[model samples]
Target chain A: MLRTYVDMNLVSGKQPHAWDLGEFYLIDRIRALVPDIDLTDDCAQIELPYEGTLLFTTDAAIRGVHFPEDSKYIADGGFRALAGAVSDINASAGKPLAALLALVIPPELTLSEFDRFLSGLLEYSRHSEVPLVGGNISRGDRFGATISVIGSSNKVVTRSGARPDDLVVLSGSIGGSEIGRMIISGEASDADIKSLDSEIIGTLLYRHLRPLPPLGLGEKLAAIGATSMVDISDGLIADVEHIAEASGVNIHIELGKLPLYPGVTEIAQRHRIEPAILAAESGEEFELIATMSLKDAEELEKLQMPMTVIGRVRSGNGFVDVTLNGEPIPPGFSEGWKHF
Target chain B: MLRTYVDMNLVSGKQPHAWDLGEFYLIDRIRALVPDIDLTDDCAQIELPYEGTLLFTTDAAIRGVHFPEDSKYIADGGFRALAGAVSDINASAGKPLAALLALVIPPELTLSEFDRFLSGLLEYSRHSEVPLVGGNISRGDRFGATISVIGSSNKVVTRSGARPDDLVVLSGSIGGSEIGRMIISGEASDADIKSLDSEIIGTLLYRHLRPLPPLGLGEKLAAIGATSMVDISDGLIADVEHIAEASGVNIHIELGKLPLYPGVTEIAQRHRIEPAILAAESGEEFELIATMSLKDAEELEKLQMPMTVIGRVRSGNGFVDVTLNGEPIPPGFSEGWKHF
Candidate 1:
């Protein structure tokens, strides 16, 4: 039987002799990474969300761009891309329900490596509870995966809802992702991350590969009535500008009040750069910047979420101003990720 | 004032001066092609499908892979890719509700070219009735797009439902897409497409760029209770094998009865290949293949759809047999598309 034929090739990391790209052949590849995928009927079918509204978002991760394409870390690319996609739903305070993945599998990659990539993707899909209900795979020159996530929330939030004087909140510390990357790439180490406790190093690497989105926190955000919110994938300085522009308001971040991730200051020292600047420019942190009333902010704090008031919204014409102890920091804002 | 800043560079094919990748900046680019997108709140919000079950599918068109990336017909790539994506929904006898596009823009492309690309994508998106509700764009070495379509249907059909003795029907003719590619790439000519009537050539080329799915025909197929269905994307011969394997039965095709598009016979003759083989090997036709009971198929024939019974299902284990006027064809079944 074909099942016996394919099982022989899987363990040795060799392709099935005379393997062909057919619909049935792919089911076996997907099953190896995710054993519990409900074989979708042509495409994935899900019950319509009746309790709330649909919130759909998509993101892509490319080899050699979004992540280190080192063969050893190729699997991380899959996990990271899936993680970044789900962040958009949480940014809008929506709970993710399902995801459809489209994989561009390069002929050059060994079947073994591609399996790892799928595992990396499956790891986060399971953890985030966004089941990979269906997907498509095709041969291409390079490896990439585009993840489309469908989610829903009764209380929808947008970047255009900020009001003047709303307390700007940061969901968690920044720069952890960047430090994780540096350690992985072997770039820094005076207070080198690898030299630290194995536990700390593992934590940093895990965060880099799969930064967990603050799950279930979206409900609290909506319950407390977040005025405006955006995730920190584009860095703090750049994303605040998004809020300011969309809401037609000005935002001033107290640079000193910005919390740095645990190893960020140490890594910044090793890299010999201003830790605050590093925090301000780090992208893909997957944290959140939300603006809300001070009373609501206090209530959220009691929930023990790792959130801090890093800035304040002001009435003005779409300008983001960062300050250190009430003094404007500088002239040029640190560059964020530019997609074009 | 901010609107004026971005609009000044729109027509002249120049990047917006001091252009920064922000959520607001993307809104302007998207608005250029689709003038009426109700700017989404964090993500596109669509009402849950209340009438039927949801069918979600995704596909990717990579540069120089799915279509030619020549600058002149770059726009066609967009239209073609979007068209191919919607094929899956129709295959399942479902109605497309919405689509999400993820664009990978290359810096080497001009602003005018990018605008043209968006227009191309929007053109077919409009034609297919699958609105572009939301998408993401990122910088990459080559241009690409990943499209995910969400559809719905009251009666669902899959490839696994074929029963022995069922009549196999094809929605439209094959080999048109292959001919279009030949014309566009200037590969073949004779009783050539170019020498033909401008309108006929135009129609053929249009079919190549945007092969219309037999829209709403799925509703009719479901009405008469189609047992198994798939779109003729991977060529008829290969797709027939899909139905056979999925349904655990055999499919026998009468090659003499295989319908050929208007110019397919001429183009295949010009290329010095048998017309039937070319038709069997052709991909991206976007026609539907369905198997139904003999009585239901007779009812479907009276509905005036461009469907013809070209084959039948038999009791067996996943073997596809092709016959020429009740005689075995040749030494090798013509090679269909092998994505890997």
Candidate 2:
């Protein structure tokens, strides 16, 4: 049932702990699904190839399957659980570079509680300069963290580059990491948090415990052309049906042009849950869902962090409709979060 | 009680699972400790300042701490517990290259019993082309195996370059891996099977389950002119008291010029133990202990895997002595295998 992409304009960026807005809309949807790498910054320029291109990816976070045991700072929850496996190689725009990490703990841990979970993953990799390079400390019988990153993308954003009428966009906002996991799972009630909106529930519990993606906007949406991309860590109708089954095409959306944030429709009417199924199955909400050309979304709405269109693409293959007023609404019954 | 270096030597020439042994004897043992850069074999000739070099080391093996928990490829017990942490960058003659693997397992395992422990570590890293690259699967809540390797050294072998009267050498043989973990723990019996010498009990159970070090022979003893270097991975009197406390001095040795092997004194007289404390603390011996200049061990004993001498150096400070018959002896009760 994977379908996310609840779209609040895919994280609006302005640097929360380091530029948020759902990590600049999943680096503008992995710079339009990697247009020959260079995810934009913080060192990444590989050349070696006798057997190069082996940058694999794997990220598991379980324990209530993704945070909240006593929540927050188990070393930025092991630096956002190894920054969601180096944000799937920075959402394929690539270059989050080197990682293996593999932790598991839980057997009533201690070695100084795994050194405060490696002091919050070495101060979130020394404030994200990212260099714990390789890892694997164990005990596990389950507490989970699993990482795998190995970046180096001189150019490679793949999800099958979108086409047809294109223009889907996003990059931020969706359901405040599903109303910050319903206020860390009490299922929100302090009188439904006095009819909420506290600066959009403190930016949806700071996008569910510090998300901040959009680093170097995936080489500026593959240097301004972007046709297709992914990374909405399952939401927005399960990451646009994985960009409609990796670009074969057909997407649609428009549930009254979705972009909600003010108390996610009264916390989806006090937990009956359907503010687009807590923004379509709430995953980590990394954001980014590209597919350009509405004249490059009017020149990416004159950059400075654009992308917000929300839906189009055609010629059929996957989720061919979502509508709302015109009918079809069977599109918001939880469409993400799966592990096993 | 930490001492182990399961009697050294793996010998064999240049690259075929690569092995050079030189960085001129690890820049005569760590060029006065740290910073010199550019070391090559070409392939972007070195120069990696900080975006890399996180390399770490951890080794552990215990059943009797380093082997024999039942054999016949009990998955070369996780490929000699990751070739004893890639024999500490092949005892600083360097090259281990990459690794992150962290297995703890033991809940009486099964998943086809750890797929023959990843098929004896992907057949010894596909016969040593080095590449387990990423890892961290867990369960261990401990039968034995700790491995932690993370290599890349063109010039990093440190034990403090032995000066004084130099020439200590060794790179091979020493109470054959405690006579192959006493014939895989039956403490030697197989009753006179084949009236003794089965080619020195099959080269002491193939150097106690493949201890093989020699890889990139520390960049060919740091491109010749060897000086200092370690890698006997504990023992040889605690790795010559860690190169006589990092080359402050003393050393000596002799004990009828060590070496031993061929049915190591009939497997230390059927396991009564002492063959010099099972050649000083028997552990998975990867070998190495360098230090040269007797005109670079008579010009690296005219090439093709040479080295041997067996001891010297003087000026004193870290005391290591040894001799036998011609005198000394004392420094007995050796110590090596110490975790915690």
Candidate 3:
């Protein structure tokens, strides 16, 4: 009998209205879902046995801007939101301890949709071993969530530690998420998504929906003597520019050595756009870009980490220079992503 | 000069567009405003000195719900948002160290409005000595802020430790914020607000605009052997019910003993409503509600901590009972504030 109500409320789309259920009922439901959460208190308490530094980061995903409201990817939206927040912890070389989620929901959204979102969030939390310790829900005109991740680290990495003679490393490939977003946002037709090989479609959709940041790899990089690091949240050039400005050094990228996804060139050609533009300008990649010494980079390479050195730091005013085919590239090659 | 550009951009309302200035440009402005914040990293790191527990809490303030979009109370909304978040730390007998803010802004909001909101947030951070370590800004239909407070304590107090014979104490008065909201939301007329005395208006507005939570009081209560504690963000009855349910004890409140705001009676009379209902149903009180032994309660009273004993815990199934003039109160007396 209880299972019937649960299924009706969470799967059949025949659930009581949120206004009728009230806030406490929703909180009770969440508590039942995440039983480890301490919902009886005003604040969640976490004990730290050893002395360490606490790392904090917050990220938000809006309905229209970050995800489509009308699409069937609501669960994917939740996964992406939490993953984006956890990616910051990964970038900092810290072990995530817990997370706090604040969700703003529109009245038009149904309980089943909310349940799917929570399922996605819980799935990530269970996989990452970071419990959802605290949260708040409020009414809003559109659905959105702000996820704050709390982490701890013995040795913290910052974006201002790179030196002049460091090699810049790119973790894995970029531009895949942008391609996936385009497909999900209907910029690409259903036939376009279907005509693509299943592996490519699956890979692109997975990358776009649940872009997993390689956790623990950041700590390994830190141990291997990475000087500075940043996540590719706002595209390669833009994010690297942050490291350059913060470290007060110039970065020269060997464009010919840039890493690209397998089908990026074909997709860009089909879309009548340059592959370099997609590689440089696509955002939400969630890949780490770090700077290290040549010896450290060689050691990391030997360890078989999925990263490639694509640039070198120089002593100059903070600016990024690009070279292609052993020649200085002209200005306006790839402006990178701009968010406002 | 930079000052001219700032004034023109912020005050003259003829500023460069947000899209033109870009997200990074706004972040730079915020960094300049709060110079102590470390903005050059993906995560801000805080060192934990010794063995202790970390307290985490998050709260959100939506534009239409928490404050009117057309009203000039945007700054007050910001102040209330941070204060409400900090109140959770106070409830747990914790000292806040830092906060992370995530703001969603509409495109129509001016640069000056955003500046004022930040000013309000910074003012609270400065006064509380809790730094704004990190935050994220994104676009949305209406302005809203989610504030996550990180705190620490040697001994934490929760809401589940009250004994059967414990006494319930309230730190301060209630119902002023609700009255102020009525006025601000235009449910009450300008004449209704004006007919009230200046002192009453000032007190109500102050309580409404910037609800102050007694932070050190919770710690002091914990040190003096408080069994359980909670902050009255919801309402007196609603919040006390939380302690009762968590502690697995019944709470009986003496209606005549409630600490009501000075103008509560007058405002209730003017509105043709019962003062008890106002005291019981108002939200955002931000006052500490604690449970302790009679001896500790007496000691606290002797210290003149602006608290009064309103109820006592009894061994029973978790429930709240109300009494008036030594008579048992009936059901549906005070339904309390409902958030939906």
- Comparing only chain B with the true structure, the TM-scores of all models are 0.90, 0.35, 0.92
lDDT of each: 0.79, 0.57, 0.82
The order by descending lDDT is: 3, 1, 2
* Most lDDT-accurate candidate: 3
- Cα distance off (Å), candidate 1, residue B188: 1.9
Which lDDT tens digits does candidate 3 get at residues B1-340? 5456666676756854442355666788789889887777888888865656899988888887876676478787788889999999999999888998888878776666787788888888888888999888888888889999999887799999989999998887888888877766677777777678988887888788888888788788888889999998778888888898998999998878877887777777788987766887788888888999988876795556788888999997779998866688775566666432
DockQ of each: 0.58, 0.02, 0.83
Model 3 score (lDDT): 0.82
Q: Which candidate number maximizes TM-score?
A: 3
For residues B253-320, could you state the per-residue lDDT of candidate 1 as single tens digits?
99889898887787788778888788887888888889999989878866797888899999998888
| lDDT score of residue A26 within candidate 3 | 71
Off by over 4 Å in 2: A1-66, A70-83, A86-88, A95-99, A102-135, A138-148, A151-173, A176-180, A187-264, A268-283, A289-340, B1-216, B219-336
List per-candidate RMSD values in Å: 3.6, 23.5, 2.7
Task: Kindly list the interface RMSD, in angstroms, of each predicted candidate in the order they appear.
Answer: 1.8, 13.5, 1.0
Write the number of the candidate with greater TM-score, choosing between 1 and 2: 1
Per-residue lDDT over A200-262 for candidate 3, one digit per residue giving the tens place of the 0 to 100 score: 877887887888888777787898999999888888888888888998999988767777876
Candidate 1 lDDT tens digits, A233-326: 8788888888898899999899899888877787787778878888888788888889998878878867788888998999997998888777
lDDT of 2 by residue, B1-340 (tens): 0011111222232111100122132222222221231111000111122332323454444333355555345677767777776776666555665544434444454433355655675567667666654333333324444444545554554667788898788766776776676676656778833457677677777787766777777658756766777666556777777778767898887766666666676557565664655675665566776877777677675557745777888888888887654577677666663321
